[model samples]
Structures are given as structure tokens and as C-alpha cells.
Target chain A: MSFLKYRLRMDKNVHLIMKILTVFSIVTILAILLGLLYKAYPILKTHSLTNLLLSKDWFPQKELFGLFPFISSTFQVTGLAMFIAVPFCLLASIYLSEYASKSITRLVLPLIDILAGIPSVIFGIWGIILIVPFIRDYVAPFFGKVSSGYSILTGGIVLAVMLIPVMVNILLEVFNTVSRGYKEASLALGATKWQCIKHVLLIKSAPGIISAIALSLSRAFGETLAVLMVVGNVTKSPKSILDPAQPLPALIANNYGEMMSVDLYDSALLLASLVLFIIVLFFNIIARVILRRLEKNNH
Target chain B: MKFKAKFIEERIFKILMITSTSIILLSLGAILGSILYKGLPSLSWEMISQTPKGGFYLGKSGGILNAILGSFYIAFGATAIALLVSLPVALYINIYRKKFSKYSNLVRLCLDVLWGVPSIVYGALGFSVMLYIGLKTSLLAGIIIVGILIIPVMIRAMDEVIKTIPKGLVEASLALGSTKTETAFKIVVKQALPGIITAILLSFGRAIGDAASVMYTTGFTDNIPKSLLSQAATLPLAIMNLVSSPIVEVQNKAYASALILTFIILFLSIISRLLSIKYTKNKSH
Candidate 1:
């Protein structure tokens, strides 16, 4: 009877421990959700979501906190990055999935994985060392002498490089899921290899590719390190790829540490974050929707 | 004639594919080469072992010893706390699927949002809360922020792994007259050890690489942290500090510190890839 009682006690202890852990996890999740809400509250309360989001001036120093410049810059850089990353990621994915021998894929896949592992800061360093100088000396000079120093071109290029691994990795997963029979059928139809890839494989994987680009674009928009290093951190509308401009992330990161007025600083930082959160949330939802639609179509 | 055309087409396709793969390979090579070339000249023992002092150009007077040690302390502390919090929740949702599964989906959505939230946002939130709670800018605040930052990653990774443990193993253990607790703790978790390790490693790498979130929460103090609440710097922040300074010597030290951080991230990633490969192989078998 004592042995059975001891066993029951042990079981009870484990159950108790599990219950506590569950409660802790729930509390942690609640805390994060609450934190996001708390951060978003100031912006939501002070500004109309439309005005705050669409206004052009980001003068936090004077407390005119229109997020338009930041939003535009975020989109511009992300747009530029996607322009660069999509083609390369697609080509690489094609190579990995359709063209490369098994041995070659094995070797190249891990290299891409390593590229993914390289920290953003290192990318920033590389941008500073290479991209910034190249832009200043060569690219900017060709565009008839832009004044505001670090150009959107620099930020865009650096962001493009940083996003390559992410795009490739996600697209590779999608490519791997392409039905082998589709490829075989296209081949049996006497289509050229390029024609088959262009027509059949690309068409089938289009949704997945879009999903991957959406995910990568979100990452590029939120990217702080490389942009901070290269975007010149100047608050203005970008005239050309070579014009200096402030991205939302660079703005937040540079000012969040040093702002003097509590309300101004908190409100500005929180507002930028809220904007970033919404942008990311929007992309994530789109990716999920597209992926689900693809699944349904396939089924 | 058709056979010859097919063979040539395949050959040309193979050549084009090989060429494309080589471009990615070459770009990666160039990036790494540029970092090493720019950074290697300044990397040294002294740079690794001292702390930064004054503006740039003061030469390699201080090392990253404090930052290196503080990084490990905060990362490990946060990982331990996050794991303690995340594991059982994963298990609970997996085990009592019918009773709590709705909440699990909610948890997952929260995790996804949390992951998507920019690190700067996390820093801002942590600053407000930590200051409000009187933790101030200290290692404790940094650890807490990092712990929060890593929770989503940990829970997601662990949940996927734990959910994969075959139901039959747990049922077998229960059929031997074991309690549910024994089936979960002794049988299920042990079977999922490799996955758990992967989760921990991924979170660890994330914590180590993090900068923006911890920047405000842990104010950059050059002194080594004497207590949990003391302000301390980590490698990422230290590198940032060094880079922003105008002194050439300090800039060199910054490069060296950047190299160190890069190497650490590289090593961790290699290990993660190897572990993932092993796990995949095992699953296939």
C-alpha cells in the first residue's frame, strides 16, 4: 500500500510540474502580446492610422511624426532588394532542383546554409567596406553627383545580398515539392529543357515563389543593420537610387538610444515599431493565404 | 536523331545549371573574402582579451573579453529560462491535443507575430518595462529581453520536434502499466532529444547574434558585469561602438571584434547544419 502511495505521489509531482510549466508558457506568450499592444497604443491613440501611415514628414525632433518617409524608404529598399534577389534566387533554385547533379547539390546547399548563418552585422561590415565605397566612387559619380552621402542604392544593394540566402532557401523547399511527373511529362512531350522549365515547372511553382518573395521582402523591410550602415540615415525623399534617405529601421535604431524627451522618443520608437509590425504582419498573412490557396488548388 | 537531340539538350541544361550554382558560390566567396581581408589584420590575442577604452585610434588597448563572457552568460541564462517555459507547454499541447489544441494554435500565431516583430521593437518594449520595474539598464534586463525574444523560436522548434515522436512509443510505455507522466517524461522526451538539441542550438545562435533588442536593455558598459543587474556589453554592441568611433586604431579593433562574432556565428551554424542533416537522415531511415 505504501509503495502504491509513493508511486501516486511521484505521478502527482510530475503532473504538478507540467501544469506549472504550461502556465508559465502561457504567461510568457501573453506578456509578448501585451508588450506589442502597449507599444502600439501610443501611436494608435495619437494619430489616425491612415494619416500616421501616409504622411511624409518623420520629424520626431519637432514632434511631427508622419511615417510616410520611413514607409516609402522601407518599400523602396525592399522593392529594390526583391528586384535583385528574385531572379538570382529563382535561377539558383532551378539549378539546385533541376539541373545540378546530386553531388553538386549536396555541396552547394550547405554553402547556401552557411551564407544564411552569417550574421547581419557581418553583412553590414561588408557593405561598409565594399558597397559603400563602390557606390560613392563609381555608381553615384555616374548619376551626376548626389549630395546626401550614403544613397538608397547602397542600402538596397546590401539588403539584396543579405536576403539572397533566405530567398534561395525558401524557394529551394518549394522547388523540391514540384511533382517529378510534371517534369517527366514535359520532357516526354518533346519540349526543350528550357521550354519545359519555363512553361511547366515555373507555372506550377509560381505561388510558392510568390510566397517566398513575400517572406523575403518582409525581412528586407525590417532589416536594420546593413541599412543603418549604408542608408546615410538622412531624412528625405530619395531622388535617385543614389540619394541619401532614412529607412524606418535605421531611424528607430539610431534615435531610440539618445532621444531626450520621453514622450517624443517613446512615441516615435513605438510608432515606427507599430508600422514595422503591421508591414510584417501583412506579408505573413499574405504568404499564408497564398500558400493555402496553392494547397487547395493542388488538392 | 531524337535520342541525340535529347542527350545534347540535357547536357546543355546541366551546363547552365552548374554555371548558375557557381555564381551563388562565387558571391559567397567574395563576401567572406572581403570580410576576412578587411578584418584579419587587426585580429589578435590582445584584441580578444581586453575591453574598449576611449575613442577610436587609441590602438588595441582593450579586448572583447568582457563582451565575450557576458554574451555567454546572457545567452545561456535566457536559453535555460525559455526552455523551462516552452517545453512543457509543447508537451501539454501535444499530449492533451483535444483538450488544449485550440490554445496551441493561438500560441503558434503569437509565436509567429513575435518572430516577425523587429528587434528594435523588442528593445523599446524591454526598455519601458524594465525601467518601469526598476531593473534599469542591466544584464538582468538584457537576459529577460533575450529570453522573451527567443521564446517563439524555442517553442516553434521544440513543438515541431515533440509532435513528431511516434504515438505508439508513448502507448507502448503506457501499456507496460506506466503512468501518463512516465510515458511523456521518460519515453517521449528521450525519443525527441535530438530535436530538442536542435531547438536549443537555434535559439542560442539567435541570442548570440542579437544586437538591437539587447542594446537598450543592457546599456553598454565597458566594465565586466559583477552582478546580474550590472550593465554589460556584448560583442555585437561592442562592435557597433567600435565602428561608430572615428579613431583608426579603434576601427581596427572593431574589425577584429566583428571577425570574432562572425566566426562564432559561423561555427554555430555549421554545427546546426550538421545536426539537422543527421536528424533528417535518421527520420528517413
Candidate 2:
């Protein structure tokens, strides 16, 4: 009896130590978020939120730091990338999950993993070589417009490619969650394969799709180097897909060092990062909540 | 006519699916091909062995040894630190707590959130922390931030692997008079060893390839870092810096650097793949 009690006490001590370590990790995450906000407070205090977000001027020399252009560029690029990515991801994932043979599926999953693992800077280099010139010479002229190739369209295409592997992986997993029995039931009811997929599987996995989009959207919004390298970092809101624009990340990456000599520059950059952090946190939370509910429902 | 229309719709959708999937696969080929085709000619023995000389970006003589070594130093250091924190958290969540307990769920939520937080934001945060601590841009600062960036990834990967351990084995150990911690380290960890190794390699690849988080924290230099305090260069940053040059030679060298980076990532992924396969086979036996 005493030996058993001692063993239990030892177990209790182990659990206590593990608990403290786990708690420390959570605290560290919170501290990171708070620390960014703390560093950004000076800029937030000085500039009205409305002026900072909505103003068009971004001249740091005179202390007028409007972020509308960068914000709009971010939205435009991400929106365009999502528009391209969704249909492609839907079709590809549907094919893989429904139509492909096991050997094909096995071959493809690792390829997708490889795609996801490729570094962004390499993608940026690919963009400089393939996408940019293709846009400048072939795509723009075909539309009877001239572009420098480093435009919103280039950025969108590059980002769309970067986002595809992640989106497809999640979506493929989501579609796979629909049991064979469920799919066969719809088919057994005299529905064609397409009808079963379109009406049953798609509807069943709509929540999963939403979470995937939220997760990938956060990724697209935060992507830095590839977009920065391809997108012409002009400080103006793009008037067209062909026009050059600067997203918030590129703005921070490009100017953080040189602009530090300017007053409140650090605060301004930190504020930009804070805004990014909040939006990403919001999307992540939405994804988490939806995923948790999905798991609960499944069980 | 109605039956024929339904059949036609099915056929068309199938075709569309096949086409889109093919396009994705083809682009993968295109990316790999473009890098290899452009990078091969410019890759030289000296490029891998020597540091950059003056005017390296101006079509001058040099290699990327500095960035190569610096990348290894930072990635290895960061992965080591991340593993120190991540293994404990992974074990704690899996071994100490109930599977669906609120605290465990909360920790998972935090990790998911961290995973979604962009590397660029981490960079910004790292820059802030460095300033707050009065640390200069150095290899140490880079390692700290990159370590933070990869921790969630490592933990999530390890957690997934640990979760797949058969309940019977764990129960058997505990029933044999082993304490929970002993069962965890001796049984659970041993079973998950291959996965843990794979997770480490995967995170190391991510750490080495990451450009944004290290951009601000690790100040770029032309030479290999002499100590943790010294500024260090990295391949991704080197590629970024080199590609902007007007000189054709310099741009080609950028491709060569990209080639090198791609090869390193590919090698790591292959190794992890082989390890997982070999171990899973051993387990079945």
C-alpha cells in the first residue's frame, strides 16, 4: 500500500512539471502578441485609427503615414489569388479525393508535400523568370495594355501558386472525410457521380471548405517574400490588375531599415505588423472554432 | 434526352477535374525545371566553397559559402531550441492530460493560432523583442525568433504522431507498475521516435528556408559568422539580394543559390520519407 502511494506521488510530480511547461508555452504566445501591441502603442496613440487606415498619403518624412494604399493592395492581391485558387483547388481536390486511383493518389500527395515545402524565395525567383516576363510581354499585350510585369497581376498569380498546395491539402482532407458509404448512398439512389458530388459531398463538406479558406486566406494575407519580389512596390493603390501596388508586408520589409531614421517609423512598422497579427489571429480563431465544432459533430 | 444530359454533365465535370489537376502537376514540373535549367550553368565549385569577394554582385568573383554556413548555424541552433520546448509540450499534452480536456484543447488552439501567424509577423515580433532586450541583429537573435516560429510546427507534428500510439501498449506499461512518465518516455517516445525525427527534419528545413523572420533579426554579412553575436547571412536573403542585380552573372548566381537551397530541402524531405517508411515497416514486424 505504501509503495503504491509513493508511485502515485511520483506520477503526480511528473504531471505537475509537465503542466508548468505547457502553461509556459501558452504564456509565451500571449506575450508575443502583447509585446507587438506594446511596441506599436506610440503610433496608435499619435495617429487616429481612421486616419492611419484610410488616408492615402504615406510620406514618412513629414510624419504623414497613411496605410490605405498598402491595405488596398493587400486586399486586391489576396482577393485575386483566392479567386484563382478556389476553383483550381476545388477541381483538383475533387479529382484526387473522388476519381483518382490509389496509386495516383499516393504519387500526388508527396508531390503536394514537396510543393508546400518549397521556399518562398525560390518561388520569387521563379516569378522573376517566368511570371513577370510572361505578364509583361504576352499577357498584357494580349489585353492591349502595357505593364512592367511587376504588377498586382504578377503578385496575384505568384501568390495563387504558393497558396495552391496548402489549400488543396486541406480541401482534399476535407473531401476525404466524407465516407465511402455516404458517397455510395447518393450514387445508389440513382444519382450520377457528378450529381452525388455536387449535391451531397459538396454540401456535406461546406463547413470544412469554409475553414480551409479561412486558414489559407490568413496564409495568403501574410505571405511576404514572393509577393514582395514580384509585386511592384508602388505606394499607390492599383487601379487595375496590371497596375503596380505595395502590400503591407512588402511595405514593412522594404522600408523598415531605411525609414528607421524617420521619426515614429519603428512605431509605424510595428503598427502594420500589429494589424496583420490581429487579422491573422481573428481568422485562425474562426478556423479553430469551426474545426472544433466539425470534430464534435463527427463524433 | 434528360438521361443523356445527365451523362454529359458527369463527363464534362470529370474532364474539368482532370484538366485542373494536370495543370497543378505541370506547374510543379515547370518550377523545378526552371530552377534546374537556369541554375546549373552558373553553379561552380568555387561558389560552394568560397565566400564572396568585393564586387560579387557586380558580376565579380565569389561564392555563397557565407550564407550557406550561416544558414546551417542558425537552422541547427533554432531547431535545437525549438525541440527542447516542443518535445515537453507534446508529451505533456498527450501523456499528462485527458485527450479532450479543456486545457489540452486550449493549448491546441494556441498552437493552431501560432501556426497561422505569418513568419513576417514573427519577424516583426522578433525585431521588437530584440530591441526590448537591447540585443543587436545577430545570429543569436535570428535563432531565437526562428526557434519560436518553428515550435508550433514541431509540436503539432509530434502531437499527431504521438496520438496514434495504441492505447493498449500504454495501458500495458502502466499495468506493469511503470509510472506514467516512465511509460511516456520509455514506450510512447520510442514508438514515436521516427515521427519525432521526421518532425525535427521538417522543421529544420522550414527554419533554414525561412527568409522573413531572419531578415530583420540577423543582420546580413559577407563573411561566415565568427560567433553568436556576429551578423550572419542566409541563402534566402542572399537570393533576394542577388536577384535585384542588373548583372546577368549575379542573377544567375541567385538561381544557383536557389538550386542549392532546393536541393537541401529535397534531401531532408527524402530522408524523412525514408525514415518513416523504414520505421513503420519495422513496427508491423
Q: Which candidate is the best by TM-score?
A: 2
- State the displacement of the C-alpha of residue A226, model 1, in Å, after optimal TM-score superposition: 2.3
Cα error of candidate 2 at position B242, Å: 0.4
Cα lDDT tens digits for candidate 2, A1-299: 99888878978887787788788778876887788888888888989989998999998999998989999999999999999989998999999998899999989888888889999998999999899999999999999999999999999998999998989988987887777888889899999889999999999999999999988899998999999999989998789999999998898888877766888888888888888888888887998788777777776
Docking class of 1: acceptable
Give lDDT for model 1. Answer: 0.77
- Candidate 2 local lDDT, B242-273, one digit each (tens): 99988899999999999999999999989998
Which lDDT value does model 1 have at B20? 62
Candidate lDDT scores, in order, read 0.77, 0.90
**Stretches > 4 Å off in candidate 2:** A1-14, B1-3
* Local error of candidate 2 at residue B133 (angstroms): 1.4
